[model samples]
Target: METLRWQDHTLYLLDQTQLPLTETYLTCTRWPAVADAIRCLAVRGAPAIGVAATYGAVLGAQKIAGETTDAAAFGDRFLAVCDALEGTRPTAVNLHWALARMRDVAAAALKTDSCTAVVGRLEAEAMRIDEADREINRRMGQFGAAELAQLGRPLTILTHCNAGALATAAFGTALGVVRALHAQGLVRMVYADETRPLLQGARLTTTELAADGIPVTLITDNMAAWTMKTKGIDAVIVGADRIAANGDTANKIGTYGVALLAAAHGIPFYVAAPVSTFDRTLEDGTGIPIEERAADEVRQCGGLATALPEISVFNPAFDVTPHEYITAIVTEHGVLHHPDSQVLHEFFRKEGI
Candidate 1:
C-alpha cells in the first residue's frame, strides 16, 4: 500500500507517528496542515516528506485559487506556502528539491493564462514526482539486493533507523533492498537499532518487517557494535537523508557510529538511496545542513523522562558518515563503490541525470 496519496484534492498521509499501534491517516486539505504533519513527524522520511511537500505545493495553489481570482494575490500566498513547506525539514535535500521542482512548475504555469490550468499542472507535477520516487525505490531495491548477494551467504543484516515503506511514498530504499534480497533467499534475519530519541527502528522498521514477515530483532542504539560481534552479522545497510558529492552520507542520528562499528568489524557498510538523495553541490558532508531538534526529544521518550527535567541535550536529527567508512552506495543507477565527486559526476553523466 502507498504511504501517502492524493484524493479529492486532499493529501492523505498514513500518520506514521501512530504506527505499530495504530493504522491511521491524516488528511490535509490545506497546505499548512501538510507542513504541520511534516514538522511533527506525522509524515516523515526524506523521500516521503519530499512527496508530501510536492502535494503541499499543489494544495497551496488550490487554496489560493479558491480564495481569490487575482493573479498577484494567488502568486503571493502560494509563494508563502512554498516557504513554509521548505522550512519544515532541512536535513533532507529531497524536500528542498521537490519543492523547487513544484516552484518551477508554478512559475511556468503562472506565465500562462488560467488559474485552473495552474492547479491542474501542479497536481500533475506532484503525482509525477511521487510515481518517480516509487520507481526509484524499486530499482534501488533491486540494485542494492544484488550487491548484498555478492557477499555469497544468506546473511543476517543489521540496519539503523526506519527506511521501510512507512518512510517513503511506496516500496522503500534500505528495506526495499532487504525485501529484494529476502525474495532471493539470501537473507537470514535483520537487526534493527531502536534509533534513540525517535525509536523509529523499533517502532517503525520492526513493524514494517513484521508485517511483511521478515524476521527482525530489536536492539538499543548503544548495542550496535556488540550486536555485530555477537550476532555474526554479515553486513550493515541503512538509508540516507542526504549524500554529498564525495559520498559522505547523512542519515538518522547514530548512523555514523553504526558505520564505524561496521568498519571495525570488517563488515561491509552500505548506504541505499536514489540519485535524488545525492547533493552534488556539496563537495562533502561538512557543508550539508544538520538539523537540531528539541531538547525534550532527548530527555524524554514515549513521554517517560530519561533524565532530570533540567538536563541539557544536544539532539541533532541526523549525523554524517564520511565516505571512507562506506563500503559502497546502492542507488537506482547502480552501486558506486568508493564514491567521490569525479566518480559521481561520471555516474550522473552516464545516467543522463
Candidate 2:
C-alpha cells in the first residue's frame, strides 16, 4: 500500500514534496487535491505522476457523480478535471498523455447506460491503465537487461536521477535495466548522480538501489565527467519522460549534460523506456519542450535549516538528451539503433500506436 493507490473512495500519495524529512501521506477525497499534489510535486516522476493523474481523473469522476446522473454533465466535469490536472505540469508529456487517454475512456463511457455505470467503467479503465503501466515496466526491464547482457562482462554503469520503482508503478525504466542486471548477475557497480537541488539520485535512487543490494556510489552532478573519464564506466543509461519521433529524449535535469559527457568518452549511451514514452508528434529533440524550473530550486535549496547556509546551489528538474547522442533506445519491443527516426517510426508502425 504505497502512498499512491486506490482503496475505497480516497487516493493515497507519498507526499514527495515532504520527502527525505517528514514522511507524510496525502489522502485525497477530491480529485483536485490529487491534481494539486502533482502540481506541487507532492507526487512526481513522469509515470507515477501519470498514474496518479489517471486515478485523479477517477476521483474526479466520483465527485461529479451526483444523484442526477446526466451523461453530458458527467463528461463536462470529467474533462474539467483532466484539464486541471494536465495544467499542473506541462513538461512531463505523460501528464497530458495519461489524462487524454483517460478522457477517451470517459468519452466512450458516456455512450453507455447510466452516469453511475460510466463512473464504474471509468474506474475500471483507470485501474487497467495503472496495471498496464506496471506490466510495461517489468517487460521494459527484461528487454533492457537482455541488451545489456550482450555487452559482455559484469559492467560498470553510470545513471542520472532516480528512475526506480518509486518513479513508476513498477521496477522503473532506465534503473529497471540496472535492477534486471543485478538480478541476472551481470552488474559490476553503479554510479548514481546526486542530482543537485532535488537530489533524487541521492535521496530516492540510492535509497532504493542500496536496499536492493546493488553496489551504488553517489557523486555530485558535476562529478559525472570525472567519474566517466576516470572510473572507466562501461555504459551510461537513463529513462526518458518523452522521446520524440526522431529518438530525442527528455529526461531528468542534468541528463543531457551526462549524455554529452558519455559521448565524448566513447561510452555506450542507452535510453530505456516504454513505447508509451515515444511522441510521434514531435519531430526531433529540438521540438521537444524543455521545462524551465523556478529559480528558488537553483538558489535557495532545501535542507538548509540543519546545516550551514554558506553553500550555494543551482537546480533544474530535467534536461533533454539528443537522439544522435544516444547509441540505442531500448524499449520492451526491442533495441532501436541509428537512423533514429526511421527505427522509431518502424516501432510505431509495428505497434500501431
Candidate 3:
C-alpha cells in the first residue's frame, strides 16, 4: 500500500488515524494542508513524513511560482515552506535531512534557472526521494533478514509500533525484515505491542502484518515482558526515528522498555532503519530533542476518556534505547553489530557515505 503519493501536482496521503477501520485518503493541494496532515498524524512514520514533506515542498513551490518571477523572492518563499515542514516533527532526522536536500536543490536551481524551472526541479527531487525510500527499505530488509537468519531456526519476533509499509513510502524497516524472513519461511510469528496513546501498533502494524498473511499476535504494552518470557521470542526488532552518533536510538515511547526486556531475556534487539535516520552531529541521545504530545492523547482512547478530566499527564512521543541494549543496527548498507561511536563512524566512513 502506498503511504504517500504525488500525482498531477497534488499529494495523496492515506489517512493513518482511520487505519484498519476506514481506508480513506486525504488530498493535499497546498503545503499547509500537508503540514496539518503531518501535525495531526494523518500521515506519519519518519521516512514517510520526510517523503510527504518533499511533495509539500513541491506544492509550496507550485503555489508561489505564478506570483513570483524573481528567483530571489521564490527562494525565500521556498525556504519558508522548508522551515514549516521541519517544525512539524523535530525528533525525526529524516525530516530535516530531506528538507536540506530540497533546499540545496532549490538553491542550486535558482542560480541558473527561472522560478518555474526551480519548481520542476523540486518536483523531480521529491519523486526521487520517494523512489529512493522504497529501494532503501528493500535493501535494508535483505540485510536484516540475513542477520536474523543466524538464529538457524524459524523465529518468533516481537516488535513495537508500526514500522511496516504504512509507516514508510512502501516497504517497511523492522517490518521489512519480518517480510523478508517470512518470504524465506524463517519467521514463525510476530508479536505486536499495542503502543499506547497512539496505538499505532494495534491500529496499523498488526493490520499490515495480518493483511500480508504473516502470523501476528496483538498484545498490550504491559504484556511484553511476560510474552517474551514465555513465548520463545527470538529477537525484538523495531524502527527508529533518530540514531545519534553513538548509536543511541529514539523510537516509539515504549521501545526503551522493550530493549531492556530483550536484554533481560537474552534475546537480541535490532533496530532497522535507513542511513538517513542517523544524526551524526548529535553526540548522544541526550541531544536528540524529545517531542511531548498532548495530555488528552494519554487520557483518551478512540475519542473516549480513560482518565479523570482533571488528571495530569506526560506523554513523550519517543524514548531512547542505548546502544548497549541493542545487538545490532540493520541498515541498507549492512548490519552493525554492537554499534557504538567508533563502529558507526567506521561504517559510514568505509561506505564513503
The number of the candidate with the highest lDDT is 3
lDDT of 3 by residue, 103-170 (tens): 99999999999999999999999999999999999999999999999889999999999998988999
- CA-RMSD of model 1: 1.1
Steric clash pairs (candidate 3): none
CA lDDT, every model vs. true structure: 0.91, 0.82, 0.95
Candidate that beats the other on TM-score, 1 or 3, i.e. the better one: 3
Model 3 CA deviation exceeding 4 Å by range: none
Could you give me the TM-score of model 2 versus the true structure?
0.93
Candidate 3 positional error at 197, Å: 1.0
Worst 10 residues of 2 by lDDT: 306-315
lDDT of 2 by residue, 223-244 (tens): 9999998997999988888888
Each model's TM-score, in the order given? Answer: 0.98, 0.93, 0.99
Error of 1 at 19 (Å): 1.8
Please report, as a residue range, the 10-residue window in candidate 1 with the lowest summed lDDT. Answer: 69-78
Top-TM-score structure, candidate number = 3
lDDT per residue (tens digit) for residues 166-245 in model 1: 88988899999999998898889999999998899998999989988888999998989899999999999999999999
